[model samples]
Target chain A: MLVRRFVRRIAQFLIVYGIGLAGLLGLKYVLALSDYVVPDISLILETAKEVIADYIPAVFSTLSVTILGQVISIILAFSVGIAGRKSSWLGSFIRVTAYNIQAYPIVALAPIIFILLGDGFISRLLIASMICYFPLLLSVLGVMAAPVRDIEHFYRATGRMTWQLEVKIRAFENLSKLTTVISGSATLAMAGTIVAEFVAANAGIGYSIRTALYQSDLAKIFVALFLIGIIISVYQGLLETVGTWIIQKTSTEASSHE
Target chain B: MNKKYALFTYILLFLPYSFLCLLIVTHSAQAKEHEIRYRLKWLFNTSVAGDIYANKAGYFAAQGLQVNIKEGSPEKNAINELELGRAEFGVASADQVIRALDKGARLVVLAQIFQVNPMQWIYRDDQPEIKTLNDLQGKTIGITFGGNDETIMRTLLTKAGIKEKEVKLSGVRFDFMPFFRRQVEVWPVYRNSQGVILQDKLTKEGEAVRFFNPAEFGVNFVANSIITSEEMLKEQPQVVEKFLTALLQGWEAAMNQENETKVLAAVKALDKNTDARIMQKQLASTRGLVLAEAEAKKIGAIDMPAWQQTEAIMLQAGQIKRAVQVEKYLQVR
Candidate 1:
């Protein structure tokens, strides 16, 4: 299942990336644009070959930040979502604050972040977490707030209901959705880190992209995008596989207990 | 019913005729005016005072040309716009032109605007003056990696026979905190624009600052220049001549110290955010760069040796794969 999922993700990314490249090439041909504007396939391939070695290390640096940021965002999102699941005023306040904080664009806040934190790992991580946190929180909140009425009623009537069991039941019932949201947020985390690097930081693939832009080298940019897309697809696929295993393991345990 | 149908047919035929007439009128007007788009290399500031002056003072109109002077940013590359058929003419740095040419972009240089490149380093007056290239040794200098400043700085260091480890090279962003905190002893800035602002701020704080111009140290990397597609120059040679003449005239008049106040007012209208005092100083600094005493009459002369040196510098720095023989592209009117 894991191998199949990984293969499927990689195939899907290649197809989409191929189509995008074809579209760009079509535009270039129709317009008769020089390599400076939209590079030909040969130029892109040559540039990719030239830059791949240097870019791999940069990509790994970005990937490391992306993984760390996603982990941090997931923890924060789950905590906030679970706490804000109730209908109390405190819960409402927490939800409102999360929404408001997410509304402020990260680009606008980046300068202050850089000033306070400097353009280092911390700022990139902070920006990445902030970017991916809100969406994950929204998904978690939706799942956690909706009660499993039929199951919850049985426990409540028998006076055996506890918050821990209640939370587990809700999470278990919505396991698929939680997994999807967490997996999807990885893309946002990657995007956030790239933006942080593009805007200020001196390292990472995004910084390389920025340098490529300075020289107006579209081929290098194309290569960078290809690597980023491939890496993120693999990551999302792994997340889904892990999620499937967890779902299968939990269901088997519950059946055995019964 | 038959009479009504005949009247409807007549109305439809008349509509087509009217549309054709309108198209012809617009075409004729455009032909008479010779409308073209001129993309600037940067935003509206003292750096582009003459460009602003040209439009405001009706220089293009005087030459029977209708030019839409578009402001430019890093993303709004003139070469791309030219290829995309969006702009007929533009201002690009020598490095950009050479790089574009290396990649098969058919661009031509019409004029070199800045005799002295405005990209320079600023340091506190208290620091030891870098009178010699060796004086740069051990100084923590800031350069925007992947920018022309970085190439120019590297070339300077190489000329001084200094290794990379000899001086601490700090990569800078748009932020100036590192420079302000004295963590980076030298910072790169456009001498006319950011240089003026920084100097003004430091001056107000009872501190003096000095600019270290690369040109002074014999690194004559060319800056901004007027450029057009090779096709435009070939097909519309007359129009190109008219546009270049009017642009050079606009630059000449704008740089004349006598027209300083009028030029300042024109620039102020476009750039409302900059302080009036800073704008004045920026324009004064720009005048010297744009029109050195010997080249005062020829505001837009193309410096051939500087262009060759610029190409050489880019080649040595690996900014370009090979020399594009940039001289072939420079069409000095």
Candidate 2:
């Protein structure tokens, strides 16, 4: 039954995305046809190639930062989240802090961080970490705080070990939210990194975009945005697929017990 | 023996890393400790001769000065920056230093860069609408506030007996092509930059702007003077002298035909898209404007009457109400 529901949702996602993509592609072709009579399509094509090459590195760099940021955030989130959930007062402060940090993206922090840390990977790392960490904290808080009463009572009644109960009850229950937050945070980290680079960077995709903007090189600008979009989409899809497998495995274990 | 070996090995491993950290720190530290700070008229534009020319010629370096060449906003508040001590010196008109002296700021002129005003009023050729100063009698002229170029123009107008109330007013040309294409009729463009550009094109086609030269007509302020605080003049007179000596050398190198390639290369490095020959032509214009007729006269020297005449024009132009004694403002070298 769950498989059927998941498949229907997946189909809906694809249909919506496909229509949007196809419409954009159709519009692009129509615009190209309506261009000046002696079209310099090759010039634009070459420009696109340069832009793609520049973007590939930024996409990869952002992915790496995002992954590091996500991992750190997860560890922090879970630890803080569990403690806060157990203590009602602590939970409110943690929740408020975590929610506010979502707004601390790279553009906001890059300049000050550059001044303090002296501008390089360290400044960028802090920006990415701040953006990525917030989502994980939110996800962790939601699940740990909202653990179904029946599951909690069962664990308490069984006199099961705390760590074991944590893995089975809270972790199992919150897997979907955990995966979603991790993927979202990673993508957000990439965006934050780009904005950070734009302000005080020697080089990066952000720097490339900045220089292009300074000189009014529009082709390169579009190219950078397109490649960033492609990278994020691919990562998101990969995360969701992995998440579905985990969900399927957990469900199968539950069915076996039944 | 084992502990000693471990200690030695650790030092060897960390030695290069420590050296690299030291290099980075030293480099950035050098930037902050620069003795001289120069606020330019524009952010990294090659049109201004001082920043790029000074930087390129190693003139500042020879004076034991590390110049932090910062960008300037459209304000030409270079005088304000000088007064504020955001920097040791700034670039503005010689007339500005004179006017600003009486107004509670003690800005002193160090050296004059452009003796002839490389400043002019440019109008579109198609605009048969503006043929003379009388034709510009009611047109909106875009002007940058607190600048000598606009001040000089207004004075020339008053001398021609044109009233300020008679003409329409607008902001300076923020957009280049639109201004040139007659969105606005009159603007103060740098003679070496936009004025020579439009003139050459028009002259090539045998038509030109009915330009009223400020120097020839009425307003003649010394254009583009290297300025410092009056305090810097008294405190570091020797350092100021050395700087002037270096600048004279730079100007000679910059103006001569033999150093044309070197200057153009420097120009191109600062602005990548600048056309080489056009830039050289502009370079020629810049050199020509810099005491072209007055080279036989003392270099970096100003005549007292010329300075006062320029200031009086500004007063008539209504840029400033107060009079500045030219002798009190000038450093008699």
Question: Share of real interface contacts recovered by each model?
Answer: 0.58, 0.00
**In TM-score terms, which candidate is top?**
1
Clashing pairs in 1: none
Best by DockQ: 1
Q: DockQ scores for all the models shown?
A: 0.27, 0.02
Off by over 4 Å in 1: B1-34, B293-297
Write one digit per residue (lDDT tens) for candidate 1, span A22-117. 766766776688999999999999899899999999998999999999999999988988999998897888888888998999999988899888
Docking level of model 2:
incorrect
Off by over 4 Å in 2: A1-258, B1-34, B60-68, B74-77, B80-85, B124-149, B164-170, B196-211
DockQ, candidate 1, vs. native dimer: 0.27
- What is the Cα-based TM-score of model 1? 0.93
Could you give candidate 1's per-residue lDDT for residues B218-300 as a string of tens digits?
A: 89999999999999999999899989888888888898889989999999999999999999999999988888644343788
